[model samples]
Target: MKVVRFICRILLGLVFIFSGFVKGIDPMGSAIKFGEYFSAFHLSFLGNFSLLFSVLLASAEFIIGIALLLGLRMKIASWAVFLFMSFFTLLTLILALTNPVSDCGCFGDAIKLTNWQTFLKNVILMVPVMVVFLERNKFSVRYKPLGEWVTLGILFTGILLVIRYCYFYLPIMDFLPYRTGTNIPKAMEIPEGAPQDEYKTILYYQKDGVTKEFTLENYPWQDSTWKWVDTKTVLIKKGYQPPIHDFRFTDQEGNDITDLVLYDTRYVFLLISPNVQKANTAGIMQAKSLADLCHGGNCAFYALTASPFSEIRNFTEKNNPGFPFYHADETTLQTMIRSNPGLMLIKDGTIIAKWSYREFPEVERLKNDILGYAVTYYREKRESLTKTILILTLLLTLAVIKILQLNFDRRD
Candidate 1:
């Protein structure tokens, strides 16, 4: 029983930690999911607070996981975990039945689960949840309340800082289809053997002042007495879909330039803004300067947005941003980058690099040679090193705290 309890606790802790970390790293993505839920349930009034709810939920999950893994404050942590799991399990059950949102966004974009899959996952997790809850009292090790609270306070603060950094910049780890190194065209390809969607075609017809629904097999096409009212095609089963299915680029004149951009061998600088009206003006100006720099070199530049043509015209008239604005899906742009105005560098159809508005490369920095390989290589290397260091520092700090806690308890 004791071994079972230990394994259950560890398993639950790791699952919670992973779930929290993924959502925390991409809080905006979670917020968007929350908005979808609110809209679906007619509770859209709370849409403004989605981000706050997202951060708080993620933080609570992380804190509970840490407490469980480190065997700290078991009484309270166990209760919290039990309640949290119970609530979400019930919620997922409802979602599975209703099928409002396609993906629950429980693991952010790191993992995608269908409504039924999410409910099943929650149901399976209940076994460990019950085990931990039942053994909560047995693992209730006494500790100095002040010290425990202080440690949690510090940890929570660090989590908030990391979330904020990712919100302003971009997620340290990109899980979207448009992540760096992805070949845009290749990601959108559909394999020849992919399964096609299965649909049930229902025909509505009226005869003798009465309407009846019939399948295509039964529908009397030869009978002139029956009049066809409408036809409904219902999807019975979904099929394989490409990751970048929604990706497209439409110019102001309603011309498709997706292939033109993807086939270009020269480096292409793309400024993506989901909403032109909400985009930062300063960031747009910076993008314009970057566009100028690209034009001077062997590169191309274009701006893609989801805003309507009227809004685009208004924005251009007001700011005079000397770059052409194309159209793409709003959600697609959001998936590409978190920032209001983000920059992407693509070469030969591959996403070479991406940057949030705050980190837009300066014109002077690339004046020497805009397409120089060394410049992008070192930048990517530096950013990768920074992420590794930050993660290691946090882990080391937690390890030290756990060691000190154990040592202090031993002395007692």
Candidate 2:
């Protein structure tokens, strides 16, 4: 029984540590998943805070795992594990039964689990947690002193902060649909009837301090670059023609036009929204506000929906969004952005920014982004370079600690 308990503790601790570490690497992805839940519940305010909460949750998992593995506080660690697993099991079961989301995002981008798979995983985890909790008092282990606990708490907090910083500055991992992905161009189709202009040029600043310009036509290794950059979307360069099959649908006025195109020189705000009837009210309100901001800036704002013209026109008129509405294929819109109400910013046919419904930075906040594009771009680059180094360092540190503890145990 003692051996079984010890083995279970190690297994549970390792599982939690791995799960927590993977999620920590991509806290933003977890937050994005949480945002989906918030959207489903019509809780937009919680959306912005989801990422922060996700980091904290992941850090807790790591701390608990460490405590369990170290045998530092058998009673408390066992209880914590039990409670955490219980809550997670309930959440996963609800998610599985309700099917509110396509994915539970259990393993972040490192692993993908369907709703049923996540539920099953949680159920399996719960069994061991329960066993540990019930047999916790049977294992004789002293709790950590207050000082050690405080130190552990501080360490966990620091880890969470570092993870959050990595996520905001440069995502350590890309698990979400909008993560710098390879299929960006194909996912966001440029309409055929859209006007063509000069191809937008990319000013590449190489690490060797050489600057070169490349257009989409002359862009070297386009596919590889797309994959390397993990570009979720790109602007359709001016003067570059889309495939002839890129058809534009008509509006209520019978005008065969697309609401906004990548060819335009002006900044374009493309709101790829689900049907208004199906969308959250707060999301609809946010879209309206964004449209108002675009109108104030004389930026082209187009609300693209998969609904029929009559339904969209009526919704627009009723909402008084003041922006033109266009039609797009439902699947196309979904592939463009994972969020039900997704926004994309394009300038001169180059995609500048994108946000899920929950992560929508207000229009006023965008000025800072525009002004600091160079800094932000470089920061993202640096963070990407450092991600592998940081992950490896953490793994090595954990392994060394475990080895030292095993040596101590053998000596005892």
Candidate 3:
């Protein structure tokens, strides 16, 4: 029983900790997910506070996991875990039944699960959390109460600093389809003979002043007296959707320039902002400066946005970005970059470099073969992320070892 309790705590604690950290690093993405939930539930009024809410939820999960893993204030931590899991379990159950939101985003973008799968995952996780809660008294602290408190305080401070840095700069890792090195044209392409959405058609007809629904197989379409009212097609089964579904660039005159831009062999700089009205002006200035930097070079510059023509025109007049303006879907722009005003460098339809407005590349940084440099920079970034993850895992492993050692020591 004691060994089982130990195993449960270790497993559940690791899951919560990892899940929390992933979502924590990309708070804006989580906030956007929150915004989606708000829209689904007709609670857009709370959208303004979404970031804070997301950060808080993620922090709580992380802190609770740390507390349990370290066996600090076990009674309180166990209770918190129980309550948290219970609330989420009920929420996922409701989500499974109603299907209001496509995903609950339990593991952020690190993993994807359907609503039913999320609910089942919650059900499975609940068993261990329940065990931890019931065996709370088994957890004992090796350090003094003050030691645990101090450690928690340090952890809290570190988390806040990391969150603040990521919020200002970009996330340390990019997990989206538009991440550096992704071939946009390739991601958007559907292969030959790919499965299409299977839908069943239903027709509504009014007969004797009564409207009745009929499937194609049993429809009374041959009868002249049956007047057609409406037709609907229901998706019986979903099909494969490309990662880049709605990516297109349109000129001011609504001419599609998607292929032209993607096929360009030279460097192409894309100034992307979902909504110009909300983007920070500081970033806009730097991006405009980049236009001048690329003018004499064989580079093509374009500002792709989802804002209306009126808004785009107004921004153009005010910013005077020395580049042409194009249009894309707002959601696609968001997925492309988290920053309100982000920059992407593309060549031959492949995204080579991406920068948040805060991290706009200076001319000095663009000093080499632009494509090769961007690829190198992306590789270095990945390596850095890998190192950070490794360091954290090592630290957590040490902590677990110490905690286990303390438990055995106490028994002796």
Candidate 4:
């Protein structure tokens, strides 16, 4: 019984911790998923609070996981876990049955799960949840109430800061297919002998004021009296799809210049904005400055957006960004970067680096060589993020050790 209780507590704690951290790191992505859920459930009015819900959910999961793992406030943490799992488990069941959204976004972009898969995962998790609930009172507190809450408050603040930084800048870790170093053209390729999509064609026919649906295997091909009403193709099975199937660039005149730009020899700067109307004005101006920096350099600059031509024309006329704006898919743009106006540098179809507007390279840094500066900046940023995570982990470890030491002293 002791062993079982320990195992259940650890298992549920780690699962919730990972789930919460991943979602917290990409709060915007989680918010986007929440908006999708709201729209699908015909509760679009709640979309305005998606971000709020996203932050709260991540915080709750993280706190609850820590409490369970450390045996801090087990009474409350166990109840929280039980109630949380119950609600989400039921919600996932409905989602699986209705099939309103394809992916449940349970782990944000870090892990993709179909609705049915998510439901099954929750169902499996419920076992440990039940055990933890039943044995909640068996665990002993290691610290005073004040100490436990102070630690939790610090953790909560730390998580919120991390989320805020990621929201203003970009995600510390990129999980999307369009991450830096991905070759756009190569990522969009389909392997030879890949299975094709299998669709069943259903033909509808009307005769004598009656309509009947038939498949090609049973259709009355020879009957001349049957009048064709409609044809419907249903996808029986999905096939292999490339990671970047929906990415394309269309010029003002509706010309596909994807190949031309992707195959270019020199570096190309692409400023991506999913919606021009809601984009930050300062970011737009910063992008304009970047365009000026690339004017006579070995790089060319362009802005790509999902906004309509009218918005683009109006924005261009007012801002005069000194670069062309092309049209792309809104969802693709959103998937590419979390920032509204983000900068991406690609050369020969390979994404060299990406930056949120807040982290955009200063004009002074790029005065000498744009590519050289960008490469150095990207390397430094990557190292910085890695170091920050390591420091946080070390601090948490030290804190836990100190707490354990204090508990031993008190016992002595």
Which stretch of 10 consecutive residues in model 3 shows the poorest summed lDDT?
A: 403-412
Best by TM-score: 4
Segments in model 2 whose C-alpha atoms lie over 4 Å from true places: 39-52, 138-147, 177-181, 185-412
Q: Residue 250 of model 4: what lDDT?
A: 94
Between candidates 2 and 4, the one scoring higher on lDDT is 4
Clashes of 3: 0
Q: Report the lDDT tens digits of candidate 1 across residue range 352-378.
A: 878889888777866776556536754
lDDT of 3: 0.83
Candidate closest to the true structure, highest lDDT:
4
* Cα error, candidate 1, residue 195 (Å): 0.9
- TM for every model, in the order presented, reads 0.93, 0.50, 0.90, 0.95
TM-score for candidate 1, residues paired by index: 0.93
Better of 2 and 4 by TM-score: 4
- Model 4 regions lying over 4 Å from their true place: 407-412
Q: Write the per-residue lDDT of candidate 3 for residues 27-107, one digit (tens) a residue.
A: 888999999888888999999999998899888888888887777778888999999999999999989999988878888
- Which is better, 3 or 4, measured by lDDT? 4
Candidate 4's displacement at residue 63, Å, is 1.7
Per residue, candidate 2 scores C-alpha lDDT tens digits across 1-412 of: 8888888898898887777887787675577678888987689889779967888778888888877886756788998999888888888888888888877777766777878899899888787788799999887644325533644665576567667655544344544444432333453566677676633445442334444555555655643433222222345554544322233545656666553365666667778775666665466668777677666665667777788877777777777666676777665564455555777666655556666666565566554454255346446666866886687669756754554444334322
Q: Would you list the rank order by lDDT, best first?
A: 4, 1, 3, 2
The candidates, ranked best first by TM-score, are: 4, 1, 3, 2
